[model samples]
Target: MDVSARWDNACRASLFGSFSLSGPDGAHIPISSNKARALLAMLCVAPQEAMERDHVSKLLWPGRFQAQARASLRQCLLILDRALEPQNITMLEPSHTMLAIEPSIVRSDFEELIEALNDLRIQEACSLLATIGNKPLLDQMDFGDQFRAWLKIQRKHVEGQLQIAVSRALVALDRDGDMDGHAQLSEAWLACGRADARHWDGKIRIAVLPFEQRDAVGGPFFLAEGVVEELVSRLSGVSALAVVARASVASVANSGRTIPALASALNVSHLVEGSVDRFPDSIRITLRLLDGPTGVQIWSHRYDGTLEGAMKSRPHIGANIIAGLCKAIGVEAHTRAARTMTASREAYSLYLQGRALTYRAIGDGVLDKAIELLEQALELDPDFAECWTALAEAHVNTIVFTPQLDRVERSQRMADCAARAIELDSRQGHAHSMRGIHEWTLGNPLGALDHAYEAYRLEPNNADVTARLGSFLLYIGHTQAALPYVEEAIEQDPVYGRNFAMLCAAHFNLENYDAALAAGQRMIDLGMPGMWLAVIEAALGDNEKAVETYFRQRLLMNSVILPPAGLAPMDDDARDAYWTIASRGICSGMEDDRAIYCQILDGLHLAMPDPCDASIALPAIWMGHAELVMKLYRKQIHPANMLGLMSLWTDVDPIRQTRLHPSFLSFADDIGLVAAWEKYGWPDLFPRSSHID
Candidate 1:
């Protein structure tokens, strides 16, 4: 053999799944003798490492006499040489005392896989995994006990490397937003029990169908839906019950599915169906608990009361219905335990009206109207815990919807209302959840998590609570861990757009751009802000889409439209700079502020300046300019006001780079992220593996 041609890329071998050899022209080179193939396999396992001739003989022909084994080994080598010589392949470099496979010509699948993983070539490793499948290493080759032992160790090492590579590949796919690839690999991993189940599949699932409204004269449209919402919220507190969220139930509410079919579609064991009848001054509610599998009515009840009486008697009515359902299902009745608040019928009616508005965005004035009604209800009955919770939510909405408003003041007010609600009724999970949001808005992630977990503990089955907690986890950098919760929440409440918003953020942070775009579009369809979608388009380098989305969103918000005609002719640098300023103006509705808008517009031509001014930092951060945002934080945004840390785990390209920057550790330490991570476990993007001293 011409040993000098060992480095030639003329031939290759595959040792995983099955063994095979191919020459440079892609013709299969047949090695008919079993011992000959075995010799080649051994050499291919570690092409760079030469094996002594005697050792190779003992392993391939164990228990044979030394002379006989040596004779067999030499025959196998001759067979291999004859097979390769036909293709002009020189794959061996043999010495008098040692044998070796040329590292270049005889390169194998196993060898390449290890190298890909070692070099952190995640995409290549993922592609290689398809060829590996589930076959045992060297499955086609028969070997002696000594050789089998060597194969076992080799297989074990290969398994370990593949596991790590697959994991990293999944992360890469997620970051790249390769949903199809992630789904396929995830399915394979799940089949082999490599992936954890998102949630306990054994939990008892139940769906509360939308209540039918049967009124001669139409009352408020929210009345019937509100009843279903209340029941769903109340039932979600029962840890043993996995109550379906309002959105999912609403989706099929009018689907006209039979009871059993509805149950099957929702994957639930029991179904609660009901109808509401509103008369001139009286209301009646009829409910039925059905055996989902058989579609048999297991229990039934009717409650009748005057409008005023119904509003005041709802707690008692809801508790009775819950108690009956729980008993029918063989569970204890824990309905509204420590959850009752308010006696005024009028106050309760106002609370219902106010609470309904918070569920969906109707118009610009909806939140203001909701806040007004909730305040009036509070005045009528000062200690209504649920009303206070609803008010806090409306306030949070105000802060989010109107950026030019005093966010700090509004956030503090929201915190106070949530705190009061908790004080009045400590067991209300929604109240704790609101308080958690307040903590997050104020940039105290650890405190936010503490409250969020408490809310989850209080309402282990609440879909809203689950989704909110998941959103918090994503924002705080636990991208992977947040996935299960987001998925679980969606399963329970698939129609709720806010949960989709959370899903979008999770995918974006994971670098799953396509998936993020899909989720964000879904969010917009469901009547939520398209701001995140615009940002995602920008991250994807789709400047046209991003610009169009920004203008469209501004129009939706009733803000002045800033045309991108100038952006079309600008170079990449100018476009980015213009966008950074434009997005800030659009997002903040600063154009309405006149003076501030002019100041920002004047600086549209300037580069991102050092020591970013505090006023522009928040808007800039939202626009994905985290480098400037971080500089602002380092200079003046920490300790006294920790709001800069709010976007710490954002997935925009610039922001993602910021997290990997060396200064991030110091920023994390200064903002108590390290301490929070230590106590609660590190986030996915910044895992303990990346922890710096």
Candidate 2:
């Protein structure tokens, strides 16, 4: 048989990293000499597996006499032969005129990589390339100067081919509208780009810590947090600045660290800290910007103004801070801070209080209180675009984070408020982002994409906008594309639990289970709900851990139900019944749990719920209730039903197995999911049928 024909059946040799020959039985024959490895690598990259004896000798030992160089080459070949002999493999075929590897007897990873690329098996090619990550050919070997120079050229040529193959694959995937595939390829491309040191040139990084309240009397306690929030928001508008997220700064603010320490922790070059003192009619704001490394004060200012004047002066104050930083860093500011201000002092204060309350606790009627306060502010000054935006966001959060209100009603209200904000200020990124969320919830991906892209275009450096874009991508099953945005958001605000949760979802969708688990844990550590963590644990096959996580989530939900405490109202009996079913499903050796699970399914059917309620199907599938899932699929075809695309999730195993069943096929056909999967490549876990790739 020819070498190519026998390649798969023959013993393999890997020369990319180290010199080793492996037999069919998988034992390795190691070759330790640098010259021997280089010789093998030279042949590995050869146009053919053979080279003329004199030509090889001249390349390896150019300065030596022809006879001396040939002798050295012969010695290196002898060493390589001896190494392969132990594996019962005649790897080297040497003659008086030409030398080569016994093509039918040996193969290498390089050949396999080439074959994979030629066949357009990009995932396999990437897997093979990962084995050679960042390592040059013959990486640990040191040969003679002439051979070393040849090796350098060969290494570059090989890497260049690999990169070209990757780029071609990316183009093909993009042309096919395979967003996930494009994202993975983009990741590999970015890894290559990161090798260049100038990738992040001329970027200014800063973190604004929460301003402290020097005097706590008279003014609302949330004033300090509110001021820092506004400062961070205004500073985020500057084009040249990379502002650290408020969540990340808040995480380290109470650590009793100096300005330098805080800056170091946040990975920023500048730090902003200050105090607010409130009196009957005026507020005193003291601000200082400090150098991150040396803790030197770069600028300081104290502004005392009437309540209305201070509320209106925030943009000017923020602009001055940006100017000072620009002057200190020798970089010109490209944009000025612009904020929509309310003429009513009470309205501004009410808006600030509402904003602060919205951040207090999830699922606690804090968001509702925020809405009430913002409504009061709006009544005082109906044209307050900022207040409208804040209210819109709060309404959306009430739907997303709490189960108290009707989702349909809140979504409509959120849309209205967002539209009002956009009418008042066409360029408000927050309004655009809020509208994007509303559109996504309404199952309009194209509209969501337009708004998300607009939000990012308007405020590229805004961490919130970046995170929103990431979320929208994930919602549309473009998990890989969502990665960079979420990562940037985390880079900007490391302490933000929502960003971490989004990252967890992105990693989970990518089948990076370990990274998903880590991000989920980080979300839990940061005091966010861990519903996703439970799913991650379940996916990782840790039933006990998943059950424990479920219990913790249950406790978290119950803990927030303090009656008459301004928290969202909950149906205790219904919540308890739901948890009971979930807990039983996760526990082992419980036949009764299975019966109870079936009973819950029966009751859900009997209740005759809305056909559009697709969320319940996810939990049913997670609990291995395939019948319920099929029923849900038959009832509704909502875009929010991501289960069809999330084939890699362990929770979807039962669903995947049932994809060929008559009911499932009908469901898929009726919902147009099969055609959707055909448009993009079928997910890895999808069954390979005649209609699928």
Candidate 3:
């Protein structure tokens, strides 16, 4: 037996003993059987601490009866004891204990490698990690058939670490030397002819599939979403990886698309697929990775963990899968086994609910529901910066345009929420963007720009961050700087509406209204709200048509607010906005009865820019309740959400209505003036495009 070691170079070492392993002095011993020699190697490199008794039974006895199992376990232990005598190593008898046997002494190559890595010796970590590279583990496994779940877990953990160490080594080599050294270092990692380590290069495309419906599917199904979400969260945490976000990949699960098709559609080189199943006090999961384009099966495994006590510790299952897949792919897994953020199952469950609602159609009470769930997430994890940002955004969406709360009150609340989130963790781009928006719209533009820029810098890869910041910049009138960010945002996410408006607005302010109008037209074509489109078209010298489009949008807005006549899905907020605007005409006091499916504009409170509640009261004559209309406004009814006020006396007779409430007579002048203008055929607000042509 020979024991040899060199830190920088490959060392020649011999597993010496009576038969398998021996002492540093090269002592000798003799084991009668080869199976005993093999078992020693097996237990020696069990990856983790120890191999237990049941594992030995499953390995050799496999499907054999009671006598065969007992005999095999006894023979294996006796052989292990004899072979390891030289090294003073001994296997726990029957080998059925919880921990594996640890060698008493070693000249083993692995010992030195472990010592070096533990010493923070980079050179040793690399050389040692490289020594164990994908060489055969237990080349003569007399027990290959015994791959138990516990053994599988240990293998996964070690493999994950090996890949991470390999990647780290490659990185150190790259930083310390020339390209050749980096190339050679990378080449050295080519175990089994693939660089499949979990070292996620930023250039690699990644596609995250939607989590399996843990709850939707039933009992354990609820955990499916959390498993997938936690995995995504962990992968993204590996700073070097260019991991895709759950939101973008959610459409796959949300739309029920097949995994293979999604892989191709998303154009990622790899795919992770899995399902989570649950029983009382236990959770079982199945997962695998595939070569996305080729559909070749890469790796597949199942984990049956007991989530008996803490629900949150369940995310580890997801983390394990990700870490496992990265190991399978040859990427480094730096996952320190810990319960962070959503360590408890309860918090994970709430996080999933919040994520699920994020893409739902905007409606009254919907955003509020999401906010509630996110608030719960924050409660579960007060230090979770991501959840804080989500909650902050939910707050913003709640009063985006409620038109009820006072501006100062609402704005202050929004700013405070955004500020607290940013204060907790400024590195979070979403938090930075949220606070930047509050500053830009209600506080200081200069300060807003600084925050927005910081957000972009932090999350350069996220289009949402860029688009949101660009939109905020446009709102604050920083059109020039806004354009490039918006352009990049569009490049990142072509169809999302937020930045499209800002992109168009940039052109609009640049006096390239044609481009702006084209952009707006695209938004309109896609069924998005026409707010920016109308503005862009008007800027492009199409004011007449723009006004027509604007009025049409207002009409739609009004109908949207009307709560739908019969079985209409009035939950859409944009539609609600349109209906509100339509009911309150910009210049016309005259009724567009056809627009509202009515005979005349009866008791519909004609919105007037008066200091009193005369706007609604003046129209009461047609319907007859001046006091009732006054009380409605004073009751703090939101003007933007007046859905069902279509009353009697609703016909066009402003005079008759005003007569009932003399104080409302003043509105008669404005209505009459608007009426005369309509009666005489009102002229266009801007010259026709045809005239310009």
The prediction achieving the highest lDDT against the true structure is: 1
In the range 605-662, model 2's lDDT, one tens digit per residue, is 5553343343355556555565666666565433334323333233244323444454
lDDT-better candidate, 2 vs 3: 2
The whole-model C-alpha lDDT of candidate 2 against the native structure comes to 0.65
Give the runs in model 1 whose Cα sits over 4 Å from its true position: 1-200, 209-226, 247-273, 280-282, 288-300, 305-316, 323-338, 441-443, 511-624, 631-653, 661-663, 669-675, 681-693
Q: Select the stronger candidate by TM-score from 2 and 3.
A: 2
Could you give me the TM-score of model 3 versus the true structure?
0.47
Q: Please give, for residues 234-336, the per-residue lDDT of candidate 3 as tens digits.
A: 6655555555555446534455545544653344556777776666566677777765544566788787667554254455555666677776665677743
The lDDT-based order of candidates, best leading, equals 1, 2, 3
Instruction: Report, for every candidate in turn, its global Cα lDDT versus the true structure.
Output: 0.66, 0.65, 0.49
Where's the lowest-lDDT run of ten residues in candidate 1? 559-568
Any idea what lDDT model 3 has?
0.49
Candidate 1's displacement at residue 420, Å, is 1.0
